[model samples]
Target chain A: MVNPLEIKVERNKHKKTKPPQDQLGFGVHFTDHMFVMDYAQEKGWYHPRIVPYQPIVLDPAAKVFHYGQTIFEGLKAYRTGDGRTLLFRPQKNIERMNRSNERLSVPQLDEALFLSALQQLIAADQDWIPSGAGTSLYIRPFVIATQPALGVSPSEHYQFIIIMSPVGAYYPEGINPVKIFVEAEYVRAVIGGVGEAKTAGNYAAGLKAQEAAKELGYSQVLWLDGVHRTYIEEVGSMNVFFKINGTVLTPALNGSILDGITRSSMIQLLKHLDIPIEERMISIEELYEAGRNGTLEEAFGTGTAAVISPIGELSWKGEKLVIQDGQTGELSKKLYDTLTGIQKGSLADPFGWMVEVSETPSGVL
Target chain B: MVNPLEIKVERNKHKKTKPPQDQLGFGVHFTDHMFVMDYAQEKGWYHPRIVPYQPIVLDPAAKVFHYGQTIFEGLKAYRTGDGRTLLFRPQKNIERMNRSNERLSVPQLDEALFLSALQQLIAADQDWIPSGAGTSLYIRPFVIATQPALGVSPSEHYQFIIIMSPVGAYYPEGINPVKIFVEAEYVRAVIGGVGEAKTAGNYAAGLKAQEAAKELGYSQVLWLDGVHRTYIEEVGSMNVFFKINGTVLTPALNGSILDGITRSSMIQLLKHLDIPIEERMISIEELYEAGRNGTLEEAFGTGTAAVISPIGELSWKGEKLVIQDGQTGELSKKLYDTLTGIQKGSLADPFGWMVEVSETPSGVL
Candidate 1:
């Protein structure tokens, strides 16, 4: 176990002016400080510190640059109405990060140490947490293999760093529906691959497909299973859900689909609200059939970046399937409101999902 | 086109002692200087230069660190018996690097600039090339997205770099056959993914499977196709070949397998020698059946790192299929010698595959 007291703090001598909250776009503006820890095969993880946000110096032959042995987690620090900072189920992200580490053959980070680092860093930079409607400080915790050798095996050194960015609301005005293209020519992941892990390579593999979808004027790509090429896997980088005949359906955790924290939370929320939900293999053909038969009521993508992204249209193989008349469905809006309300502390917490952060740096309890 | 004369050269002032030829390992010790070029959306690729080999400075939020937006190519510089330096099939690698860039949504590099960079870099560090038996300078050319943003998209900035390392013979004593494990639980790549590209993520995805194989007392993992989980894709990171009943068979250029330069050379060599060669799908079942019937004469893997690595034994689902009586097949030895001979400028350049590097730096062609 790492002692919280051992975490050194190096305050920034010169801090940049903070950008206006309204002008902050996604991942554009960063905070003053970042949390960093190093890992060596012989020394374990050491030198946890909160230092000025700066450029990282790495050998050109670092394994992360050549082999992509990296993993990351995304969550947010929300400013509640009561002037308190809250995080939505951060423990889940930490747990999933470890699972990613296991899959990527990177070293495991101590859960307590992870949480402590997050808390201390958040407390130090809490002023960057935006209070605007639907706005929050996005926390990105990533681990990269830092071994300066050009080997194809697990790296002998690593760096776990946490950087925070003040992101504007995904939807500036309101939760608008997005247009998605069903990708048939490119695949994101397959069964028994690294899709379930929040690793860098999975995202790298999807860039071409995403670019193609963009050129076709779609906001994202809805990926199918690489094997059958029919079963739904993900919408862009998010988990997909469809309300067909009043029953919510999502692709099960079948080894390839990411176990999205937001997706899991939405499922729990749906069950609490007494809405029927099912996790199974939902093929694109079945989804299109539901659209044609007028049984597909609503569709949405769930992720940390966008609490709930309503899907208004899905274009697949030259056919456009418009749901809810290309509008945000009632259930989609309701889920979005409920989830964001809980995250921002406007509504009563039913499942105790929100974890509050101390305003003062307590040096990681 | 990048002007060769525009490339600025800055030599290293204090060079470190070069490692002994006998002590050289694969990609362990780098030369004193490296080639670098920067790319920006607005400026394009510029600032081509040679500088002292040092650590690269990048923002913590660089896309390569978070999304694995990177690609690399591997080739070797061989010091001939008469002191001339040669590069085997470098144009193939340069063409393949651009193909990888296209697949990964990265900016395409000029093929002329790539070759010039390799030639100049190798020329500048010509003294580092080892001349001992089976020693060569391994050249690693790579591009990494350097945009410091967390958005999961193609980066607007990139850095292309070339580094060289002196490497000893893959098998210092002689060509040795290795034991391979046919992986079923994990997949290296799938059709419509980044597998065919020589990108970082594909290698990262294979690390876990390779580690598992190493733990099971195997030197490498023979990957099966992601969709079928039976059709052969690759052995470790190399293209696989099987010789059965006097005919050489390799997997077709499926989107899930890398098109290795050595594999291509071997095919051409087989044709030159009037040996039968076929490129098509061959499943593990068929291979094991051939082993059972004593028709699986030989097996080997081809890549730039080892040139040709013979496989003596394969373990699949608790069955050990020994090939060529656990010894290096005659064809494997002949192919290795022929290829290495051509690379080192010791044998006749029948196909003109070897490109000689100028002793003096010729900035660019």
Candidate 2:
């Protein structure tokens, strides 16, 4: 009784026109094929399959619609300098996604099954992987509660899906710095909440503040802790880092900050380069003091979407503070180049982070 | 052109079976007809109609599934003594729902249109309204983002739907007391978050703490303030109140505490009865002190689901503080009776809160 994924190719009666790579935005366009699986309490996960990209039909009372019981992960498949495709640390995303599943009470997937689904789906839609520089096929693996009940409890049924979208470089302006608003009025995540989990509710809670900040001419909102509203937590949807006095510092994962994959990779890369790095609580007051003393050399945000988003300005409580003369810091550029280089298969695989689609066992593809 | 709600009756080609009245649970049973409307940036809200209840079709990348950008409202339709259908101050729920819509970045609904939809839908399914004591048709109106793009932004398209279910009494064992665990470690919401709005994320964040409390033999978890973790915010999903030595008090409507309709009605009723009531911050330390001094006479929670849920025991940290010897307090019982009586049309309507479904204009029906 080995439950394996059954692949079904979409019969294209009409050939779909692919969008121009230069015109493509983040997640507006999707590939033709998608991976889907179901979970029930009695039979567990079953009926894994790849099907045509189409509308998902659900009962109106499904738990995902009413209770926000869903989790998701995002990574990318980069078309290498050669004809092959590469995935950076795909296994790490799967591991973190499982942790997110544990927190949201959604059922976890077998690691092999999860990896096989992604590899095969990417293999089937391999042509959709864009070859433009800094362009890649973004992979979204998410699980949603499918039970058609209107209760607040965890759902007994779930659906795991993997969808692909070809995306352009995150910074259309090319490794530019973004303006941030220090949100003293809104808190993103607090200790002992669903902050660590990559769930939808945490993102929903930040939308209001994000909208307001965008109106205020800021690209993102820098969130503070929920308790004191002083300690720095994150920047927009990404975990943040600060370079003060030759030290690379990020907020410690105090159960509220998300353990971002890109954040970890950047830290590893910085350590490998023999740069000082620390993960600890950094308050706004301390950061401002360092800025005043000219010790705040650089600040940036790290996430899958924007690998390294340098912070140029921070407006905190009507006080504007400029960082590094509003320029992308030297370290920020170096780290971004190194990581994206590794992702595009143009650099040596010292860390063995790149996983190729063809590397999976033959039976899956 | 006037945008009137078009009515479509289900043919019942196959007759539907109704669940037994005695076995009807909270949201398991649904009425035959449901109200639905669509919204777009250019067209506003259009295509208002009542259609047969069925599954909702959406793209897998819908914003509601990924970002939790959805809001909902809950109110009940009651069948009165003389076979009249009544809705208790439903306009208040609509107004609150609109506010929730605003906070969650959803489009605001037209008040008249919202009320008309409810009245017509309830009228169409009037026979489904349960006549059993303490039973009524639960109305749920929700808006979800229908856009297929996978970005964390306010959706361009939306769907608003109203579904009803005939539900039994919240407590089958009569209006008894429930044991509450004072959750010092977990926080449901913080100031400047979406706690006040009746959104899905706040409930999702509470499921874990609620599950832990239920496992520990507690019926609900009482959340503290997200900032200090000292002030009492809410009990489970309901707004909380405490009666200490004859003074009735509830947490002030800070941005985080939901402005519950039942809570407001209870406060009004208390004022009418000449019992002093105050909406201000009340600390747990003060509450425990009152318990130790025998001054904490009564406690209860208020919401649409449970009109008035009395609290009998509170387990905070290691100590168990039993209120009124683990029995329902006098005020709790009186308030429940008065509220339920008004809802059922068994009492004189002094404040003119109950709105009759048959009283609406003919064009709406």
Candidate 3:
């Protein structure tokens, strides 16, 4: 029988004992160790290890550095109220990672192997997980081309790494409101591009627009269709949701906009709460008009890190449309509460999304 | 008077000797040193140097690795009959790199600085230039977000680098014809994506299609429009051109096909040679009909590396359209020769395209 691959971890010899409340921004503080697996054409993924948090060395000609052949997944390791560490729906991340890898022509890895590796790595670095109020160990699993070839062909070698960062609340004080810029000139995703995939290229393409929005006093950009720049796609990293009349409307996954884990969770959560949700194309005109007529009750964005962030005002095309009470709406708070509650084990995980981590040798076998 | 920036050379102590002629494939042989510059929001671009060609150490959380915030420009240094090294249309590359940086939200580098860096790098790597026929030093100038952050925002820190690789002729035995696989299912670029920009993401997106074509024993995938997947975009990295009724036609630069340096160069060369050339939307239907009606004389793909590679056959929709003679056609060879002639200083630089890199460095104080 094939042995369950294990990782060796060297704990941080000098550990910090202070519970600093300031070390809580999302993706700011990382755990001590990380999981890594290397792959080559000659030999499959090997040299799996849990190494101390350090820089990765790569060839200057590596395709990932110059060509951007990279994809990543975001999930979290939450410490429950019951004092148990659990991962939420990690299989989804594994499956999506493969899909992205396939699209980018990166070498693929075993999903079961990946999940086990994550479990082991996180177990070792679990102490680095921040507890208390909306804080959790953010798990970032990513794969990249490591081949040193400079030609424009698919790389034969690859690296799959799982790194953990203790992240604070997305919103400093629970969930407040955010001003979003309606990006018209800049398009994040197109009909046939890597918009749906969590590829680095998609995110990189949005940086300028995001920078512009931030300078203009906007938190994020609400991307539109690349063709006509009319319909909404996504808000930088999150999936957008708009409440028009009664139905919660989100732009349908039309080959653009990331199929976010939180977006999917919200859809499932709405089903449990018996709330009507419509997954269809939501145009900018419809959103603006609905806001002006008071038909828009709320607008928010969903992603793994930020369970739900309310939209206060949309700055776009010489007009500012106020969404809801210019603050976190009731429905947005409800979604965040339920999701976080279930995550922290305060509420029962009836959906069986959380996989409880076994405390033995920690992440090592 | 602004003094010209001087490059500090840190040569590799253990540099490998140049490989033999047979092994000198395109982009396979690198020079001893590379030029680098670092940019940050706080300090702008600084620490410009020509360092040893070695593997770069990058943090696992570098944005370029995870977010793909990278862009690159390609040009070549050819050894002229008088033993002088030259870059063809180097300013065009600088201009294009900035355009690409704008699309990716990376900072724009000064054109003067870019040329100076290139000159220094090439001077240091001049020994690597192959003197044989059709051999030149392929220069890859790229910018990558080196910020050790996981966020999707535009990185505050960026690394700009220029590396040289001595490359042999694309086709060792004269210009050989290539078979193309027209991918109907997968679309490379769309209406408003980074297709026009020489960004890393655009290349990453095409890898899968290229792999599929390779698996099928074809050279490259002929991409089409994303929505309809009908109109011809380009074949992999190069712009496709077809000769019908003694007139040359190429797919219009309609946001999908790259505005290739060689593509435009050929158009200029053909027009100067009294050949009628049109840059307009080219459809798959038009190509197939033209090929079948014996009106299509030649078809070729143009890029920096292989200035003009003739398309032998096209496999699409269960049908095959064999280009005339299924060999390097007359117009293809003419276009290739004319372009190379200008590039090699054999012909006049009519458009004032070639910017001579003066050895004396007289432009600066």
Chain A TM-score values for every predicted structure, listed in order: 0.98, 0.97, 0.95
Task: Kindly indicate the candidate among 2 and 3 with the higher DockQ.
Answer: 2
Instruction: Please tell me which model should have the higher TM-score, number 1 or number 3.
Output: 1
lDDT of 3 by residue, B178-222 (tens): 889998766677766678889888888888778888888788889
Cα lDDT tens digits, model 1, A227-272, are 9999999976689999999899999999899999999999999999
Residue range with the least summed lDDT across 10 consecutive positions in model 2 chain A: A1-10
Judged by TM-score, which candidate is best?
1
How much is the lDDT of residue A145 in candidate 2?
A: 90
DockQ of 1: 0.88
Between candidates 1 and 3, which one is better according to DockQ? 1
> Which pairs in model 2 have colliding backbones?
none
Q: What is the lDDT of residue A8 in candidate 3?
A: 50
Weakest 10 consecutive residues, lDDT, candidate 2 chain B? B6-15
Worst 10 residues of 3 chain A by lDDT: A1-10
Better of 1 and 3 by lDDT: 1
lDDT of 2 at A275: 98
Error of 1 at B275 (Å): 0.6
Runs in model 2 deviating more than 4 A are A1-15, A359-361, B1-15, B172-174, B359-361
Task: Name the weakest run of 10 consecutive residues (lDDT summed) in model 3 chain B.
Answer: B356-365
Best by lDDT: 1
Give one digit per residue, the lDDT tens place, for model 1 in B1-365.
Answer: 68866778898998989999989978879999999999999989999998999999999999999899999999999999998999998999999999999999999998887888888888888899999877899999999999998888899999999999999866443479989999979998999888899999888898898998889889889999988888998986689999998999999998889989998999999999999999999999999999999899999999888888899999999999999998999999999999999999989999989999997766342
